[model samples]
Target chain A: MTDDREKRRLDNTIMEGLRSMPEVDPPKGFSARVMENLEPKRPSAWTRFRLWLTEPRSVTFTPVRMIPVFAAAMVLLVLGFYAMDTNDSGNGMRMSTIRFVLNDSGMNARTVAVIGSFNSWQAHDAAMRFDDATGAWVLEAQLPPGDHEYMFLVDGQKLMADPLAQMTRDDGFGNRNSIVFVNGTYEQAL
Target chain B: MALLAFFLLSASCAWAGDAGFVKMADRARECGVSSGMIGQIESFTAEGSLSDAEAVSLLLPLVAACADNFPLASFEDKLAEGFAKQVGPFSIVRALDRKLDEFRFARDMLQDSGGGVAQQALVVLGEGLSKGVPRQDFKTYVSMYGDHAPELFLTGLEMMSLLSQAGFDFRLTRSMLDVGFAGKGLSPEWRYFVRIVLVARQRGLTDDAIAEAAGTVLEDSGSLADVAVHLGFTSRDLSGRGLSN
Candidate 1:
């Protein structure tokens, strides 16, 4: 009993000594200096635009920029032609026919098609075909404003992604698909 | 007036001539080299051309800028490359790596040296365990030590042995151990039994239960053996309870 009591007393004294010891402060201004150093310096879009305007010599804007611009203009021109083809509606708002082109790249000898929520996820009847002359797989769909997720169904068994689409989501089965968002009468391919 | 004129002349000279070093400074700044390191490199670059004080002053901002922008690896590489272009590549890489390694080692040493709550916990736990303090009281003592109790306890054991060898009383040793076990959520009974077994094993107690308990609680052979040796026991006693001849 005496030994236990003496041990308790010793323990208390030791604990008190530890508790009484002053905490060692980290070097002063450590966190403040770190925060000051880490402050984000992201350049705004407008700032980027202004920088682009100023530095015409930057390699980032070259034939590369022209290619996108030309493609966009050609897309606009095609839309104009489609609108003229559907002039029979006469009501300024007319639905234009959407044409799609699908190409097969895999060696599986499979029939492929574009499927999306917009097309009720059907593949066989809704699949597009490749235009051999243009060497381009094209899709023309009349989509109302909003966003849509879609993928290419190849050979009825394989699901392929659109390599040229603007955006994608993980399909839980270790694959990704293209997403297109339509706003202001024209939708952007993602 | 003379000083002002000299400053103006220096400014004009700097602006008129491309120092061939401004680009390097900008690159160093971009690469995130430490201000001190940048200063060292810059001074080294300008040593023969500028007086020592002038060179150091010019290099300070470059170093700070580099540290701010570049990560350690990239900054080291760029600094080495810049120096190599002027000095021999081998000499600069070796010197820079040596200095940088020393600084890094010092910082790492400080971190591992137990300057924080973890260290405090270990010191407290060591003290508590050595005195055969009750497990509950030790837990209360170490209640604020946080999530690193296991690591701190393991490391604290080694520290306690060292302190014991240095002739500190059991009061300090037990307190260190108590803090190390603080907030581990182990039951007081288990804590008490564990501490007793550890201490007994350290003292060469030939109890089978005590050896088993020590084996259960401690993972490292060096530490387990250290505890056993501290209590005046041999490795054979730890392997299985056998009376010392």
Candidate 2:
């Protein structure tokens, strides 16, 4: 019994010794060191010019040198087409359908409603209906868009944003909205 | 263009050899042996005798072929030469055989005493057989049994060549020391003579040249201990060397 007890104590001591070894950590300012090493060095003007002049057989023409000529020709062509196609009638704004798709996969409820800057943040004015067959909640409203932010409310409890929609700035209360850009271009998410 | 051709040829040859090695590995695995064991057997067949160059060549490929099987970092040629000089080829085999015997005896004794010792002995024997013996010999031993003992014995000799190259002191223990005389009823003087033979073999000294070197070391140095010490060996092992003819 005494011998067994002594052996147990020795085993515990060895285990403790092994456990006491310190964990290894990466060196300090590791990210900054990596960034500093990876930063591109600027080449001399002569070296840059030599690199630009050497053309591979695959791309025989230099696109960088011809950009200005291409842009001037495109502007002249577009102006000529516009001069031939214009008609003088004020048919500008119309009440067209602006589709709202609740693309949040986390929304578990049967219905979702949009409340944001466009709808004066009103929940009752624009309630979205769930299409059970398509497995999606959608809303269609008439609105002229420059930029907007919106939030999705599901089952009167959970709040989320549409993952497939456009970007928006953060509201002070930790919520965000989907934005729409009208000129066929949207600002990318930051 | 020549360089490119050479590179292409070498690459193709390497690919073919890799495919061959894989086939050998599969056959070995099917036969319940490790690839290292298969390689060791192949090495022995390639070089019939345990000459220094033969040993060096065998060890190089065995290590390269089965790096995963052994705990060795790398075999050094100079070290092997040093060991070959210290312990003759015969003595090296005798030493390893002695170790295996002792391990077997220990295992038997443990079984007689209690089941625990037997279990421990078996574990030790298994580990020693796997790690200490060359993989090819071990595999051949397992697959072929009695018929393969001669080849396994030669494989053991090959191992001595490797150990000599690696600079291991085969006379480090009683079991290791008695290997050369375990079955051979060699007298003390004859054992000493065998030591000289081993040293000569290590120096690539032929049998006819032994008398001349033996006389010079004994006469010029008064004691074999002094000579062995001069040769970078511990003085205790000099007792294996025989005195004047």
Candidate 3:
């Protein structure tokens, strides 16, 4: 009991000595600076974007589920190559199908051929077949897109223009040649 | 050594009657004709449309054209057409002579305007000039693109020729073409402008009305489809279909 009393008296004496010390002032804005340091910091837009891009994630796809995606990619690749080939092969010329029809009222032509600038006015492979139902001569040909002047050659000798042609030009050979325009689609001249 | 070998081969080909085309091809090659053109000649002569003497007659101008580095396809195509038509060799030669004159005129005109031009440009210009497209109308473009981009002149000349063939006034045709030329990314549509006009004509629109419609579209820097729409026509109407009488 005498030791406990002595320890209490020493504690009271030290407390009294601390209470006797003078107070010291802190630097200006010290508390505000401490508060600012405690606040949460926000990253910049570029920093966030970089983090998002660099963040690792798992992409799970079963072989069955990916089959269609792979097929579509292959198709697109093939189509792109095909388009490139077409443009390169033709030197920018696109082909279109044109139907040439000649109405022979009573000429009873043995053979009819469409001849024009497209084929250099040649008629060998341009012969039209007779349609029994319509009694008109028709031939379909693949031509590059442009304006072409053509005429009907009957019996391998007589040349004449299409009666239903929208426009006719002087052939400079004392004859009229019908003009037909093709633009990468099926065109017909009646 | 190669020249002697060529001469020997040429002699052998000349001796063989069936090998007449080979002889002509050697001569063409000797005269600097392009191999592609030589092949074209071979295929044409193989058709047996011309006698050896007639083929020889046709060779002189062809060689002359080759030596001059002129557009030989035009002459070759004419020869093919003549054979297909079964015309007499003399008539074919006459036609070729006239064509040569036209080509010469076109070349001279282009040379006078600027300098050397693309062969295709010369050919289309020849056709246009012969068909009565005003030469004066082409001066602007010829001076602008004669050397670097003569194909532009070719395109312009072709458009003007088609318009002339369709019987449109030159002033109106040139004006419309000017509008098309000024617009960006409109060259493809210009290629089909004549087709649009043809469709309009088929729809019973008068030439004046057609001009007005084309003018409005051009003024707005519109496309060929726009011109069709302005005429109250659709792609279905413009797309070709069979019509039975």
Q: After superposition, how far is residue A103 of candidate 2 from its true place, in Å?
A: 4.2
Kindly report which residue pairs in candidate 3 clash with one another: none
What TM-score would chain A of each candidate receive against the reference chain A? 0.41, 0.43, 0.54
Query: Could you arrange the candidates by lDDT from highest to lowest?
Result: 3, 1, 2
Candidate 3 residues lying further than 4 Å off, grouped into runs, are: A1-73, A76-92, A119-124, A184-190, B1-25, B29-54, B132-154, B182-186, B202-206, B240-245
Poorest lDDT segment (10 consecutive residues) of candidate 2 chain B: B70-79
Candidate 1 runs further than 4 Å off: A1-110, A135-137, A186-190, B1-245
The most accurate candidate by lDDT is 3
TM for every model, in the order presented, reads 0.21, 0.21, 0.64
Cα distance off (Å), candidate 1, residue B124? 55
The number of the candidate with the highest DockQ is 3
Give, for candidate 3 chain B, the lowest lDDT window spanning 10 residues. Answer: B236-245
Model 3 misses residue A106 by how many Å? 2.9
Displacement of residue B16 (Cα, Å) in model 1 is 87
When superposed on Cα atoms, how far off is each prediction in RMSD? 48.6, 47.5, 19.0
